[model samples]
Target: MTADRDTLPLPPLAPDMQAVMDRLMAEDGVQPDPTLLPPAEGRAKAEAANRRWNGPAPAMARELIVETPGGRRAFVFIPPSDTGREAILYIHGGGWAFCSAATHEGAARRLALATGAPVITFDYRLAPEHPYPAGLDDCLSLWAEREHILSGRRWSVSGDSAGANLALALMIRLKNRDLPHCGLLFYGVFDADFESPSYRQVADGPGLTRGKMQRYWDFYAPEERRSSDPCLTPARASDEVLAALPPLYLNAAEVDPLRSDSEALAARLHALGRKDPFDTVPGVVHGFMQMSIWLPQAEAAFDRAGEAFRTMT
Candidate 1:
């Protein structure tokens, strides 16, 4: 459903960010709505569009792929030099439908550089194909095998957009078991409520419109389950569960429709007396970090996220 644009004006894009956006638009041309394309076509188009932003890949000291059951593939990026025993499980975001480890390799490598930790990113099953518990279960499966995979290194969890949503849900599922050291979530889709202030303000888009997000939700979760399933809409998680979450570093893009998701989650955490750090990077669109190769603000945001991860208790 198309939402009427709210009178609230969006913040302007950073100059560098605008340049990158313009370059992408020129290359990709005016594209059809993602929800209108077939799943295969959508995935192909997304991968192609993202390929340009990947830039020059940073040199990894070591890289390897681990194959698990059900044909799931996990990529490990080990930074050069002695980094330390800490590791990060990086979940790539593509609205729970498109993108994969290869698509996010550049960002994951940059994360490894910034945090001085090996970053592990995997191909979780996508939506309109796998959906909901299928993707979450894949993440859980990797966590289950962490002992074997991480080689006794201390680890934190990090994700972007839909991946961030899965990261939080994974933490919720593991609350009864062992927990990660912390969580670094970026511009996450925490709720299914598309009429939130940010969504209404940015209903159409320079990027990440409310309509596309609504379609993504439909692909990932049935309407009846969205509000009821804590794993699907983590904003609906109980206060107890929220309180039990590990130290978190949350950030949102100023011009994103999902910005309020991070804000609302941060506010709720504050109400519960937790002081997780939340940042809103101004003058950028949703998933701006993907352009870190060419955008100074995006690169700085990664540095900020790494610093937060390092300082979190």
Candidate 2:
């Protein structure tokens, strides 16, 4: 799909999503700078946008901050109709740079409401300051310390964008350990390759672009070690590692630079005999999950994902 100079270029978006995109373009503008900003400011902007896009938090939900190992804290969302045992460990995406559990609370609440399970999200250290392995270490540390409690009934690992990358990486890291029952990856970054067809086709985008993603990678994983670290780039995982994963549910935005990542990963999984379900959300852009309140496609994607979660758990 072609991008427009003054507006979001491409095929017509879902009627409901068109309005959400229009509002986003009007508020944040068509072209993004893609430059790294002060972490605090980036977080503030994300929080404000999340506030505007997501409706009020669903009622009968409880939120708590629990201390994890290494003095880090984790955020958890418990739905009103609590089952008390099952939960999902959701990781938020901000290119591994910005955004925290707080900024992404609305999406967490929506996931809990849709799946009928509680959700837990944590703050991993951001990059360009903490760099590679820092965020992953935080997640692993917390999981190691609290997996028993979190694994009460059924627990799965789920995330979007960089968060999805981390989720897959965690599975690879703990492949021999007690892995999650399933995974839900939404428009993730699986490889460092910038020349994929989707990247070339959507180089300049309505939301995320190839150049912006490259900048994110550079800040998170330096050029010297990125290619060698499968954890940093899950696509680099060997066939042996890919074959050991649990059931996965993946979805890509029809018009997104990272669209190819999901396709490629699905192909890899298929080749390894893990023919899991992979889907695409047509007429949407990156970060569409956060727009569930306004975009029908986003809600539909979540509903499909909820079904996958239910079937696996």
Candidate 3:
């Protein structure tokens, strides 16, 4: 599989970021798999990573505690310089296993910088401990209850990896109830199928592996619950809904196993006669967004995603 940088020559990174990259490359030890725990523990790991954050050059970030219908959620708030700008509802990906408002700090800040839109990344419930629908329910429930807080402005929803699935799924859930998002930006999304081209091709891709993905699904959706909902497996969704869906833009990394899901989804949208946008970022691996320390390409992709989103808003 090709890397993201091979397909996209990203922008130059800052000096501190370059130093961080150098230090990481100088190390000789094997990199431990980072996605190795449940949400709470993984999120704890993120806070530790926060200490190393050099901060994005263009934007500022702060965490907000949003009171959802079910309970409190940690929302990382990145206000655009323009307060009157559009708002972004973002979801972080860890297959609903390990991800937090802290983990996405730099990424959210960069997003705000590029889009000039207020970005809010939420900490939705995770699975196994909570199980199927519990986490998904928390995210969807947000849509029903958050409009009043937006001050009558239109909005967009976006997320990466499993979080991307959530964006697509949550929108479907919303559309079922006749609610609409101005647009959707989905990146590196995973589908429920056990077999796909990338799954077989990049079965052992760095940052993410096949066995680990299966483990996440095992934790996210138990057997009885896997049968019907397309949210967990958006590819399994019907064409009728795909056609009715709002404008969407999907980004797929060539070296990631989940690339197939994005490709398959693009195909489905085309077959349904939809005009959703799609792009394939090559020369990068899965989870590169978090690899900003060692991978310049990852940071660039994040920037590109942010810039592209600004226009849609």
Q: List the residue pairs that clash in candidate 3.
A: 3-282, 3-283, 3-284, 4-282, 4-283, 4-284, 5-283
Q: Write the per-residue lDDT of candidate 2 for residues 156-251, one digit (tens) a residue.
A: 889999999999888888987978778999999998878777787678776788888998888888887877878987777899888888999999
TM-score of 3: 0.80
Off by over 4 Å in 3: 1-28, 31-58, 61-71, 74-85, 176-180, 223-227
Q: Which regions in candidate 2 have their CA more than 4 angstroms from the true location?
A: 1-12, 28-40, 147-151
lDDT of 2 at 217: 88
Q: Candidate 1, which segments miss by more than 4 Å at Cα? A: 1-6, 68-71
Best by lDDT: 1
CA lDDT scores, all candidates in order: 0.87, 0.80, 0.66
* Ranked by lDDT, top first: 1, 2, 3
lDDT of 3 by residue, 1-313 (tens): 3453244333243454445545655753454454565556655664565335435434464445566555655364555464565777777777777766667766666666666666776677776577667777877777666654455656777787888888887888776564445554545554666467777766775446777788788878875555467777777788887776777778777767787888988899888887677877665556556666556766676677766665555
* Model 1's TM-score against the true structure: 0.95
Provide the lowest-lDDT 10-residue window in model 2. Answer: 1-10
Best by TM-score: 1
Span of ten consecutive residues with least summed lDDT in model 1: 1-10
TM-score ranking, high to low? 1, 2, 3
Q: For candidate 2, what is the TM-score?
A: 0.90
lDDT of 1 by residue, 98-184 (tens): 998888888898888878788999888899998888999999889877766667788889999999999999999998677888999
Measured on C-alpha atoms, candidate 1 has an lDDT of 0.87
TM-score of each: 0.95, 0.90, 0.80
